[model samples]
Target: MDSAPARHTGQNGTGPAGGGALAPVHPAAARRSATAIHPPRGPRADQARFALRPRRVHRRGRALPLFTADALAAVVTATTLPAVAPPVLSVAPVLLAALHAQAGLYRPRLAPSALLELPVLAGRSAVLWCSVAAVTAAADPARAMGWSALLTAVCLQVVLACAGRGLVNELQRRAAVRRPASALVVGPGAGASAVAAALHGRPEFGLRPVGLADTAAPAEGAGGALPLLATHEDIRRAVIQNSVGHAVFTRPPEADERTASLVRLFHDHGCRLWLADPAGTAKVTGMRLPHPADQLWGYSVQPLLPRPTRPLERWAKRGIDTVLALIALVAAAPVMGACALAVRVWDGPGVIFRQERVGLYGRPFTLLKFRTLRADAHEAATRWTVAGDRGMSPVGSFLRKSSLDELPQLWNVVRGDMALVGPRPERPFFVAKFSTVHPGYEARHRMPVGITGLAQINGLRGDTSIEDRARFDNHYIDTWSLWQDLWILARTAASFFRFRLGGS
Candidate 1:
């Protein structure tokens, strides 16, 4: 499972041309560098539950200008256009906050140039003021502002916004010179230690090294300012304990399956993942190098991976799930009742079958389904397949093929235990088994488990390739969207009674 060719090697070798491949790093002895790093050991993980540090107030403090500018603009709006309601002015700040957040203005930069972001600021300002003008006009015709007033509002917002942000950036730069965001350096060997040393020695780049995640945890721990974190759990505890906001990797986080697990782990904890390339050779699309080499102490990094589900989008997904699930539950009640009666008649009792299934973050929840097999709870959870079982009644088989047995799951959806469309939930045994054998398997838990999923629609049910099902589930998660969810729902509806359920 170890993919790094040069374990504990400090030197990151250049890869072949035209392909974004990195050659295996040379082992520590091969390159005689001052920062000759080798993997190291750490304290026992069980005893490493350190208390989390108090988070930095300066991070939000750095983005204070964006809020200030909007507040100041609202004041200007009140004085310039007296007809604009106080409530409208109050809402402007919230609008501005969302707009700036989407514009990535509030995102921290290593060495941000306020002037360099003028275009983004200008565009956001225009949009904000234009929206305000339209709202003001719609609210009251008499207070309708002319083009000049709109232009003045935009000009004032842009200038004041830029100046305020510029001041904040300067303060951040000064803070970077003093105290900066805590960081976790990932990967093994010399390159990682060197990056940690540079970051530890120079705080101006805004990264304070706290620990290292040495995937290859060497028994002879490397001697450096940082102690090697022996495992992913240690790294998680380290991140929380140190209030780490940044994760800098000396090599690709996806080089090995275990390393890739660390990537998902980092994402789950909301750390900004970066790849350190001193040679300035690491370039992937949609990445920003932020600062010059000198400013970063010769360290250049690019975002190595996509961010996890954003909080707002996540909330929105939940909101959609709740609304749709509630309606579905109400509409499906009759069908559910009929199915329950049938299950009662066919199976004698316990019309609704509740089986423990793995859900988001590997948590277990009771999944509701009309009984499709004459088996006890233990048998239901432990057995992987019962479709062709001799004990299956004729009604059970018909109910399953029609998917009417799944109607009771609408309540699960309404209870927020599952989504209408997501990676299908599985029993804990399989989750444990697949997570160990398949690298991409656990990633499916990022989103909520669903009643129907991409894997199901593609006929990856019963006895199908677990690897292929995991891939499809991960692909659905990676490309998840509201539109896609709607499309999947449509597809599921189109073939509602087509599949003879088994292989799931």
Candidate 2:
């Protein structure tokens, strides 16, 4: 009657409460409890954690408020612009702002959600503007707003919306700094340490280290008093006790079932579970966790490949490139003419240098540029020119430094062989060699070569490390968008002027 002291049955065994009679424990539960109680060795334990959680989610502060404020400002600016009736303009901006806010255009992180929201925002703005125009026309036949006014309103709304968001962002950044979300990383040994170091170093993301949870005894005592919580039949209790919102598994778990069970249990309890991808560890960059659902639910996560160019996008890009290339060719024609004269006067006859380079899809093409080397230079020589190379003629040095030598590549852009902005094409000899050297080298050829690229503007021109250049190229391929292309072009302009002035 003072009876059993409330014995509890765990996965591995039954624990007696105050020396009470032992209760029968299920065989599977007993085994699990035993295994959990006795932590595995380093490598095995790390493998177990990796098997369980393969992806990691890094949480940063929300950008919703900033987005909302920016949208509101955009609305206000559009509504107050001249030539538009205040009422009509006012309604459109609010609706547009709401659409953009709902679309999450202002999120601090650029996830798929933000990308998906862009078109939705643009479409909603279009519809709202069209509706306003239709209603206004119906109401006032004589005072109907012209197309210019409507267009002006649309442009002003977008500009102001972005500007407003930017201003609010600066203010928010100044007001109070919030710390990064705390992560509870669980793994074998050194792997866990790596995760902790990465998170600690990147405080901009606001991740604060609460503590580490591992199966094996950590080499460093669990930073004094932050218990190395035991793992028994179930990890759910341990996770909850620690109030861990995110669980990063740095190594695979011992059993697939255990991994699956952990994922389900943590997810059910409102915790985000992540597993480290094996392929990610090989790179210097830390492990990349795929989209959350992909990791937890076992979905395929592949790098996005180039699709057949969209008609509208293709035409738009082509038109812009052609028009600009032509204009540039014209404007620089005099300078080019002068350069040609200078080259002939300073060195010799051939005013252009045409080299065989690889183009889209590994196809070979001739890239034309103003001759920046002596005509008598040996054809067999393929060495990359560095600063003060003896091969460069006097005019060639000035042209190469100013990038005026690159003007003729506009012809390549005009032709189908190149794009205005893409990975810079390399010579065929180097291409074959690099392809074998770098595994992801072929990926760059997916897009047509360019006059200037993400690499070039970043000061990754001649003689820079091939590995670093490829990384930037890969990044461009991975994150390409129309806006990004435009940004690159703008940056290229600023860089051109700056370099020209500095005679770089």
Candidate 3:
């Protein structure tokens, strides 16, 4: 069921751009010129905006062939067994699949071979047939399978399963050669270049290296070896332009903070991530692979699974947000109306201030707050205002201290633009500046922007350390749960009455 790679590229990395080599752009210049804060306004800008949305999972089909081969093998082997009732025989395929899955037999592998899996397949087959013999004996002793019959059944099952799987592997290899997925090799210097070259030389691996992704600039004269993707923006553009399906890490992602941050970016784009130790010096860090280890050519490989997202829990959280936001909006309507009236009287005309703020996946959305200042739109977006700013009226100061200006964001939660509990959203200008300054600042966008987050509840409100806030936000996301959200909300409500200057 796996579809072939959408397009084919020539020997050079460029696919639709023809076979010419691209000029390398310096990493520093790219970062300096990157429009991470304000994207250009055009068709390309619109495309980039839409590209930030989470992509659909694509590699689900890659495991279907192995599942099918195992099921068919189980069914065929079941029929050859003697003295088993119809009901007992019918359970063989289902039971065999469970055993194979438990043994990681169906996991997608870079170099899949029946010979490498023969022992596992044989051992699982033995378990399946032995259980069948036991069931037959318990049901009817006269019709029970004997020891010799059970042994033969196990052998027959193993042979048939291996043959089917071997055929599947051959077909998969042929299909991969015909249409290889676009991939990005991530690492700095010679390590990344070597892996990219190996992948380019070996077509059977089903990966066509499209570029070398690293935060560091490539060495002089190395640009012609492959197009160097020096910045996250450059990498994002390459992934979208090439329809990249895979990202192979030359070293453990945790080895460096700059390299470590790209994990969420690739995951957001739905790429199959792999850690390959090409130099054999890479050490396994804290992150663990869900499936068994694999190999790419001669180098050891392992699939890099991100932190458990808990999708079911996330969906539940969304549902809770919508219901609770609606209720909170309805319950606070009188208070919100009074605040709007105060703002209108104090600031005149504009009660609701809408500004573009960076949200999940770094997408921009209009965030709503009561107009707390009389500044113009450009100044409001770019300038940092303090608590005792002369521009602020008494109404604005009270709103800031009491945290009443953010009540309007309840509508954002109801509209799916934000969540009830998550990392606080920030202006695009500050986001761009802090992302460059802090190591893990950009990672805060992985979750929905919340009106009250763990950082804010734990005294990380306005005028706090950006690094500490980023750390707390990431920790909240990594260990997020419904209970923790409720706890944060409780803490926020408990301290809502306390006077705090510069409550953002």
Instruction: For candidate 2, write residues 381-411 as lDDT tens digits.
Output: 3445643458887777788778887888888
Is 2 or 3 the stronger prediction by lDDT? Answer: 3
> Each model's C-alpha lDDT?
0.65, 0.54, 0.73
For model 3, the stretches where C-alpha displacement exceeds 4 angstroms are 1-62, 65-195, 201-204, 210-316, 347-349, 376-379, 383-393, 480-487, 497-504
Which residues of candidate 2, in runs, are more than 4 Å off?
A: 1-304, 308-311, 375-381, 499-504
Rank the candidate models, highest lDDT first. 3, 1, 2
Residue-by-residue lDDT tens digits, candidate 3, 1-504: 000111212121111111212333333222222332234577788876776545643552446788788888877767776686888656888898889888878766787888878888889999999999998899899998988888888998899899999999999888899989889888765556666767887888898888778876743223254566777777876776667889999765644446767888887788988887666532312233433457776677777654445689889999999999999999999999999999888779989989898777667899998877888888887787655568889998888777888899999999999998998887877776666555556667767889888888877766667677777887887678999988878778778866443333
Q: Which 10-residue window in model 2 sums to the lowest lDDT?
A: 1-10
The TM-score that candidate 2 achieves is 0.42
Question: Whose lDDT is greatest here?
Answer: 3
- Evaluate candidate 2 by giving its C-alpha RMSD to the native, one decimal: 20.5
RMSD of each: 9.9, 20.5, 11.9
Q: Tell me how far candidate 3 lies from the true structure as C-alpha RMSD in angstroms.
A: 11.9
lDDT of 1: 0.65
